[model samples]
Every structure is written in C-alpha cells, then in structure tokens.
Target: MKPGSLSHGSSTAWGKALRRPAALQPHLPHVRTPPTPRRAHCPPIRCGQVPKTPFEGFVARPPNSELHLGNAWSLAHACELSYLTQDEVRSIAEGRWGLKGLLCYGYGDNDGPDTQCFAAAGPDFIVVAFRGTTSITDWVRDLKVWKLPDGPLGCEAHAGFLEGVQGKWKGRSIIDSVLQGVRDLERQYGKEEGLAIYVTGHSLGGALATLAAAYMLEDPELRDKVAGHYTFGSPRVAGPRFKKRFEALAPAGRALAHRFQNREDVVSKVPAWWRAYDHVGRWWYLAGDDQVLMRNPDLWTRLRDIIDIDWDFQPDFVYDHQLRAEGTGGYIDGIEKNIVRSA
Candidate 1:
C-alpha cells in the first residue's frame, strides 16, 4: 500500500454501490441549464460540513502503474498542459506499476517536462511511490475487496493493503504528501505563475485520484494552490453526505472534475454513488448523449483561474439509490435536484 492512503478506501467507495437496491433513475436533466458565463466566487469554508471551492486540484493518479489508453491520454494532456505553464509536477507514482518507469513520463524524453520550451518554467516535479501492483508480493484468498494472504502472498504483498487502513487514503503516504507538496509550493511560489496539478489513473488509479482530491480539500487553508483534476475512469469517492459536505465546502468543487468511463467498463461500476458524500457531482457519459451529469447551480464555478481540481462539489446527476449496473437508475426528482442553489 502507498503511505498515508486510506485502506479499504476502494471498499468505502464500493460500499455505496454494494449496499443499495437498484431502483431509482439517475438525475441528469437538471444539469441542463440555460448557458451562462461562469463567475468565480470566494466563499468561506467550513470543516466536516460545507466545503468551498478554493481552486485546487487533488489528483490521486499514481505514476508507477500500467495506465490504460484513456488514462495515459489524460495524463499526457495534463502533463503537457502543466509543462506549458511551467508548474511543478509532483506525481505520486507508487503502487501497482512502479515509479522509476512512469516518473520519466513526466520529466523524460523530448516530450518530457524538462524538454518543453516552458519546462524550465514548468511545475516542480515530485513522485510518490506506494505498494504498487508489481511490488505486491503476497496474497491468500483473492477477494474482490482485500486480497487475503495465506502464506507468502498474504504475508508480504497483502501487508501493504492492511496497513492502508490507517493511512489517509488507505494507508498510502502520498495522500498527505500531495497536499504538502502544494502547501510547500504555495509557500515558495505564490499562485503567480499559476500551478497545474493533474491527478489521473486507469482503474484503481482513478479511485485514488478521487480520494486525493477529497483529502486535499479536507482543509481549506491551502485551496488556492490547486489546478486541474482529470480522472480517466474512476468510481465514486464519498457518499451523499460527503458530497453535501463538499458542496457546502467548495462552490467550484466539481470544476474540471472529469471521470472518463469507457464503454462497458467494469471497475468504473465498482465505487458506485450513494449517500456517503453529498457534495460531489457525478458525470456519466452515454456516448451518444451530451452529458449525463448536469445541474447548473455551480455551472459557473468551473471557469476560475486556479490550477487544481478539488472534490466536494454539488451535482445535478445521481444514480439509483442502489448501485445499479444497468439502466439509468434514480435520476432527477425535480429539475431543482439538478439545479439547486443557495438562493
């Protein structure tokens, strides 16, 4: 397990999907708001409750794992963009894959951040390594959640997963470091040149990205140093309360928070949404459909000039009360559910 990670975080995310009965339809139409120009607002943040948008990106994508095409594309986009701005790139590349290889993706080759014309001016590069896939040595009974170890498999590799229970994001250390990296960056470089932090992953990587965003926004003192949040294929992070808390915490909570799910993807269906965090919004893609997630109250929040993408946002889209694998579960009861606001 990566250091400072919340163990069973995936289970927590998946809990929402598992405990519910597949019933209601998903709410999406409410997000359909009359187009309006986005405006930035600075609202005071509250703890354990309401969250405010502070223009930060808390990415959970580790650098050392095997990324699917979509995730790689997202990383490439974010890395390229970060390089252009000369912002520091701190990649938590530990876990499943390994840092040494993916770390170069950010700072190596002609396409590396260092080679970019603006790279000299690019974001600082930082990499965090966790109990990645390749590193996991032991396992006992491979359950969907925690892989129980019996002998060698359970003793060595599974140890990390167990340790993760205490860490912020399942016993992974990157969680705290990711936040600290920005806090240090903010202390060193005031949000002048602009910082672009991108957190992404393939499957499990996507889940990590969500938690990282939540953990970063857990405190409001350092919201200003965030950048873009681009998750390739992620499941849900918090529950309805978590979402509510996030919405109350940040106005632009859902800004640039993109969850890219592929056609008939499996992991994408694991961390289904429930009442865990009531603040964040879920964006579902139906290929032919425009955008499955929409509720316009915070539509104006995405245009800010910050560099990071924080979780804890308000949304217009919702799945069935139960995590359903098929059909559009519980959707909008009223247009307001998709477009509610603070008067």
Candidate 2:
C-alpha cells in the first residue's frame, strides 16, 4: 500500500457503486428555506439521526493507493493553489503534464484582510484554487447567510464565498476569469480533441470550485469537456435545489466529481448539509491511516455536522469558525504530504 494509506478487505463495493448510474428526474418546484441555526452551547455534532438528504450508500474510498492518478494530480494542483506563489505553482505543475501554456490570475484582495482565489490554467485543463479565510471579516462572511436567487438552478450558499467568486478584483469578475480560462482551452483544443477540464480547491477554494463548475456545466458544450471535479476539506456549498440542478446538469458517470474529507477537518461539515445546503458529489472520507473502508451512513446517522466552537468564541461566531489547525488530515498538510509520498 502507499505510505500512510491502508487497505481494507478486498471489497471495492464503494468504487463500484459510484460507477453505477443513477436516474435523474425533472426538478420539483418548491420554496426551500435555510435551517434555523442551532445554539452552540449544545453539542453541535448530531448524535444519532438520519439526514433528510440521501446519505446512505455513498462511501469513502481508501487513501492515495485507491484513488485514480488523475484524482491525485488534481488534488496536488489544488494544494499548490492553496498558498504557493505563481512561479512555484508553475514549477510544480508544469513538469507533470508536459504542459506548454500557463496563465494565472488573482481575483480578490490578498492584503491579510480578504479571502481570494489564485486561479491558473494550462494547455489542456484549467484550475481555480481559493484561499481560506484570514480575517475577522472573512469569518463573519462565513457565518452570515443570504437567500441566493432561488429557481430551477438556485439554492442558498455562503454569502462570502459567493461574493468572492461573483465580485471582481480590479473590476474583473473572478468566476468569469475561471470560465474564460476553460473556454480558451476548449477553443484552442477543439471539442473533437477531447479536452479534459477540471476544477479543484481547498476549504473556501473548494466551495468556490464547486460553484464555478456548476455554473460552467450549465452550458451543454462545457459540460461535455469536464474531466474531473475534486475538492478537499470543502464546506457544504448550496441547498438541495442547486444540488439537484447540478446533478441533472452534470449527471453521474459523465462527471468524475469527488469531495475529500479528512478526519475532523471541521470545515467539511460546516454550513450543515442537513440544512438547505447539500453537497453534490460522492465523498472520499479518510479515516486517518488505519484500514480504509467504504459504507453509507446508517439510518440513525446524522448528515448535518454541528461546528462546535471554542469556549473562548462564546459570542464571536467569526473567530470560532476561523480556528486554524492543519496536519496529516488538514487542508495543506494532507495534500502536501500525500504529494511527497506519491513523488
């Protein structure tokens, strides 16, 4: 087995289930509201309750060894995007793909007060990576919820993350730049050439990546080109409506989307999935370095994760949400360590 990765019994049931296609139905019309926030003093972790959203049957595949090389590559790119400089990004990513062209853009103000994404592109694929929150303002952004325009393709998302993508840096929309980068690749490579498009990020970047990919897939042409969607320690992004629409838009089999959650990586469980916010892809959970196994949540298992805040953050939700912890299972350490092992 790969370093730090353990194998379970020879069962590959989870991987097999992922490959099996699921039927899609036309969306049902209904107004959905966000779940009421729970008091923090109470144990946020749902003890034993089944979630309204489908949670059973989805499985977390084993670590590095079981993941597709492409998935690993995508994760590596996402890590580089997490904090590395543009030159550093190019240095690490260019040698792997035999890529010729490189383009990079910084969308938000990075002056230690704002959250932003440093998106980059290569000849065959495009990557949009977001930086985690670094300020009191950013944490506040994470806690506040505004009704996202609801419709056939609408659901509530974290207002701050949405703003980061929708707003502009120097008057340019960050999300637009991401879309344009993929389009440029497609334009150069052409459809018949089978250009592979991918989107990835960590923490806030992961959430933004999901939003950008969902929006891009809205176009029929772009949907066909998406090769992978990978995220690490991503908080839940949108409500069930957006998820259903995204499901219909991307579909299974056609889109190879995977969401990775490490042990106790608090961000992955936030903005509760039980609430209107739901995740769109299969989850690859890493249960430390022990044997890897795949199984769905039991009937009594709760889908929504209550983010238990630190005692000191009694009144400040922002600082409570902005706690910093990183290591083997953390956003940066997990990816970087795995990349080193694979290399």
Candidate 3:
C-alpha cells in the first residue's frame, strides 16, 4: 500500500474527515484587525481555566534532550505576548512569568514603518519574541520573497526576514540588541547560572526568530548560551547552506530548535521549495486531530497530506495559521493537550 493511503489505514482520521464534502470551502482572504488593548491585570486569550502562573511546568535544564512540550507551550504564549502593547507585555512578564525585566523594541522608524518585538529576562531564562504579521507593511515584508546572501557560511536568507532582524533600533540592529540583552542577563545572573536563551515567534515573526537565532548562534560567546528557537506557522527563511551551518551550531544536532506546523497551515510551506528556500532545525508536525508528530512525515506522506486539503473545497488556510486564544485547533491548543497527554 502507498504511504498515507486511506485504504492502508496509514492516514490519520482527521485527514479522512477533511475529505467529506462539507469540509470543502473556498479559501477566503484573511484580514486581521488590530488587537484592542486590554487591562494589565487580565490574562490574554486562553484555552481553558487560566493558570495562576504562566509557564508553570517549563523546565530549562538538560538542554541536550529533545524539545519539551512544556517549553513549546510556554514559548507559544511568549509569541502571543509579542502582539500586545509594551506595557501589557511588561505586566505579564513581571506578574505572571516572574521575569525581572522586559525590554520592548520598535525598529524601522528611520527606514520605514516600525516593527515591534521584546526581550524578557528571568533567573532561569530569557525570551526574545518577534510579533507576527499584523499590518499592511508586515504583509508587504512577507511577500518580499527575494533572497540575499546574509546568513552564516554564505547562506542566503529571505531578504525581508533579513531586513526584519538587521534593521536598526536606536542605532543598534535588532540582532545587536538581542545580544546585548543576553549579555545583560548573563552579567546579572553570571554565566554559572546557565541562562538559557530562547527565540520565538509566529508567522513572519517566526522567520525572524529563526534568523535571529542563527545570527546569535554564530557569535562564539553567545552560541553556548542560546538554548533553542521555537517557531510556529513560520515560512521557510533560508536555503540549504543556512540549514547546514545552523545544524553545526545547534544543541543536540538540531534537536533543540523546532518549528511547529499545526495541521495544514499553508504559511509554513513558502517561499516555495522550488525557489531555493528551505527550513532549518527540526519540524514538529501538529497533525490534523491534535496529535503532535515529533518529526515531519516522509515526503510521500506529506504530499498525501497536502492533497487531502482538497483545493476545490479548501479548508480555511488562514484559520489554521492562527495562534488562537479559545484553544480549539490552534498551535497553543495542540501543544497544551500534548503536554497533558505526555504527562
């Protein structure tokens, strides 16, 4: 039987369900409105009963092991925080996550419209999260698919993603600011404390996270300190050379860095493979029915999965890409459930 063939029972039940006529619908263009500012005391959109403490089960030690589901859950929330105003983010960082400080940066002021991201530090970890696509300018950046020789080892990265990380904020590039933040944390806690740095984001932000992590890992001083990078629904950011160089620098031979693709998220598949772009690190496939596959499916299986999308009666690609708060069918929902099942 062919891999992922329905008759062989190799495909998931979720894949089978998608084949039903009712599941077919024309793809709609997604337009996201700006998120309204919320009171600092209220929790962000959640899946279930809210926790008293954020990232409650996160464990930063033993960095050599495979990516932990707890860490994925925590980092997903960190990406969610990037969407909020700086003051709200600071409140969550201090009140919920117990982070000592939050430094939010808005760059591109001198060059173009601003882009925003933040770095939050605590005793055990530092999280640098880039906000995902939420504006017309952000969409323009995402569509700029040209490649440039910007990554390590002569590797080329998506020109827009490279720009996103290299653009200056107060005369310092985003990459430099991230490094300086790590340095400050190291100075405060001392290297003996083993401050683990995690870079994360969603969609366009995810591409930036991968590039930023790659840039930081290239630095000999900060390489050992960076724990990993976690991205969600992120597009491919670089070519094969970048992937090769990144593996050399990553912990556990690329196991530490993971890209989570929930169901049939269309965003993760571009800038098309034919265009010489490829993903870095490991792939965590969040299957259609909430099961998390540690590694991506084989090529044949992946192709079958794509065919299951039914272009004529397409599922909402935009909906699948969302980092939803309600907890049904989003990245956070899938990872949160996986955490419980693993326990």
TM-score of each: 0.39, 0.62, 0.78
RMSD of 1: 16.5
Mind sharing the TM-score for model 2?
Answer: 0.62
Cα lDDT tens digits, model 3, 220-285, are 777887887889999999888888888777654335578888666888989999998889877777
Against the hidden true structure, what lDDT does model 3 obtain?
0.67
Highest TM-score: give the candidate number: 3
> In terms of lDDT, which candidate is stronger, 1 or 2?
2
TM-score of candidate 1 relative to the true fold: 0.39
Which residues of candidate 1, in runs, are more than 4 Å off? 1-172, 188-196, 252-256, 272-279, 282-343
The lDDT-based order of candidates, best leading, equals 3, 2, 1
Query: How well does candidate 2 score on lDDT at residue 60?
Result: 21
lDDT of 1 by residue, 1-343 (tens): 2221222433433333322222222222222232332321321111121112111121222222211223223242332222211123334222211222222221222221111111111233222211111111211111223322321111212222222321332233434545555555445533454444445432333444444555555656544333434443344443454445443433442343444443233445543333221113334322211212322324233322111122433221223221222333221111111122322
lDDT for each residue of candidate 2 in 1-343, tens digit (9 for 90 to 100): 1111112332342222111111111121222122322221211112132212211211122221123433443454454344545565566556543443455666223423244454444444555555544334555667755546632245666676787677665566767766776677567654455565666776566777788877677757677666567777678877877777776665444435677665445677788765677787766543332202122332222122223233332222121121122211233333333434434
